[model samples]
Target: MNTISSALWPWLALAGLGAFHGLNPAMGWLFVAALGLHRRSRGLVLMALVPIALGHALAVGAVLLAVIVFGTVVDATFLGRGAGIILIVWAMTHLLTGHRTPLRIGMQTGLAGLALWSFMMASAHGAGFMLIPALLSLCVTPGTGVELAASPSVPISFAALAVHTGAMMAVIGGVSLIVYDQGLAFLRRGWINLDILWSLALAGGGIFLLAG
Candidate 1:
């Protein structure tokens, strides 16, 4: 049990972070739900998730690929420490201004628009950055070079991305259902501000990377 737990925790953390990102107000669950409601089609909501997930995966994958390549040249620990400080600085910036208005996507925007918006949001929030500590553990072999050609870790990195995005979609899909059924009234009345929480999480991720 202990052995299994130790091996699984990092992947679990990635999933948890994905789930949290899914719920971030900036991710715009309300907009997706409202759009589905306006159109009177639950299928639209499900369809919307596909693009959103794709955009998020693309955003994170782009950064992960770069990191994997760069890891070939630098010590992972040094890179990690650098990332940690960056995360903390990003967190502070986000905390100070994260609640500012998100990019406006009209209610009538198409799936492609949603995809673009999601990509921008994930990028602006530094969502991919939050996953690096866990990802580095799962996919990047310490003191190794060029994982793409010679290492099994390439496959593992892809799996990690899938796991994170899958978890995110699950949360977003489930919440969209609730919001669709209940309408915007529930969200308006029930939703609480998540900016501070997200900021703290960002800082926590930085600290975790630093601790390693």
Candidate 2:
């Protein structure tokens, strides 16, 4: 029915955004996958993903809450710029220090570790900022646009979190599987070290946002 279709739009939009999040290497899933590959344990790798996803969701959720509360007063551009600067600083620090391999997923990532990893990765990448424009665009317009911004009503916030988390897990899991199955022969021989490439990509994205 038209009613059902209309109601489903926002959720679908959030799902699309979730997929978009998966597409980005800087989202931390790649690092999670790399950690998994290093450990040679799929379960451990997948476990590490939980905290990373939670952290990303929490970061975005906080931003969404701020937007909801201050929609009338906050300057979105300024907030975005501030986030960009923060990300640039984070990237610069990493670049200066060099990329260290992430810890393997295991019992080590307790609740505290989960919270810390999630917050650090999410904030460092400005993952929350990406949701702001998308959310505002959706809430301000109706039909497809509105559905894209928010759907399932206020509950859409949770749904967005689920979508993003699920998508990232799936991507990391798939990558881990492939890497494990393929073994390190090709990886070692290949000129491209995906880990380095991913790190540089993160740095480049941060720099681009800061300069823009």
Candidate 3:
């Protein structure tokens, strides 16, 4: 109880970070939502958010694990340089190849597929970069050092990530469902243009991350 309670603030902070990232247009939930709207299926739209969220959680979790395993050895300088190079390469690939066709929302790819996609995209975009700082802030806080050192930070991080991703999907899915309900034809009419926008946004984000 007291031990469990002591871990609450860090977890909450992590969750908040997840939510913040989820809200970013570059995270790809908007693209998923748009697909849902194009299909004119509210259920599918709502369902799509699940795998997307799971994918994001997996991506962030992997980063956290990597950081823990390589603690101190992997500082911001290494992460920044490595992540920058990766992002630059990815962006160049996108620029050369152009955007692929948007994925159709369905049960075939399902949750697993969605999670995989989300993880890949988030990892490519350095989603975990944001999460690391949040965790470090908690751990380095003046009075909480001992508590943080004793607590299972990884599990707490994952739990917060799950909640944050869940909330984001809910918001994006709900908005998509509403758009579909009100103007399915309008959404369908604009789907291709929207795809272009998604590609450009992703490419730009990648470039910015690399340069920053």
Candidate 4:
């Protein structure tokens, strides 16, 4: 049971972090929603998810690939500690700056533009970086070539990425639909902000990586 729990927690963490990113308006939903509003087309909103998701996946995949490459040469301890510190510092910056990104990619963007915007936003927000802790938890420590490739960890990493991205898309679609149908007034009326919680989560993830 302990072993099972230990293995399961990393997948759970990936899903949870995905959900958290999905919940963040700065991620992609808000921008897509605004774009939908501008175009007056619900279909466009739904369609846009494709590109947004693709872009996000690419950003995350790039990070994962880099991690995998580094995992072969660099020590896991060093990588984890470095990633942890980066996450903590990134979180501090987000908290201090109030998550007010200078991103002006606007609603006029086409699908390609939206994809680029999503990629940039995800990269800027360190969305993929947040997954490093959970990611490394699943990978074998400092593995090399075929040894690493033969392990279940590589396939599991792909599964983790799919699971993470899927969870995010689910939330993004759900929230976007609600906002489209009901309008933005509801958010203005009584929405609880999650930016602070996000920062805290990032910092907590950092601490977890470091302690691990």
Ranking by lDDT: 4, 1, 3, 2
Per-prediction TM-score, please? Answer: 0.90, 0.57, 0.57, 0.90
Reference-based lDDT, residue 77, model 2: 47
Per-residue error (Å), model 3, residue 4: 16
Give me the displacement of residue 130 in model 2, in angstroms. 1.3
Tens digit of per-residue lDDT, candidate 3, span 1-117: 966655575566556655555555456556666666656666777777777777777777787666555543454434444544554455555566743435343434556776676
Please tell me which model should have the higher TM-score, number 3 or number 4. 4
lDDT per residue (tens digit) for residues 45-92 in model 2: 667766767777787788776655554344544444454565556556
Please give me the total number of clashing residue pairs in predicted model 3: 0
TM-score of 4: 0.90
Give the Cα error of residue 187 in candidate 2, in Å.
Answer: 5.7
Q: Which tens-of-lDDT digit does each residue in 114-186 have in candidate 4?
A: 8887888888878888888888878754332222332565677788889999999999999888888889986
Candidate 2: what lDDT? 0.56
Q: How far does residue 18 in candidate 4 sit from its true spot (Å)?
A: 1.0
lDDT of 1: 0.81
The residue-by-residue lDDT of candidate 1 on 135-207, one tens digit each, is: 7777655455333332665677788889999999898899998999888788768888878888888899899
Supply candidate 1's per-residue lDDT for 183: 82
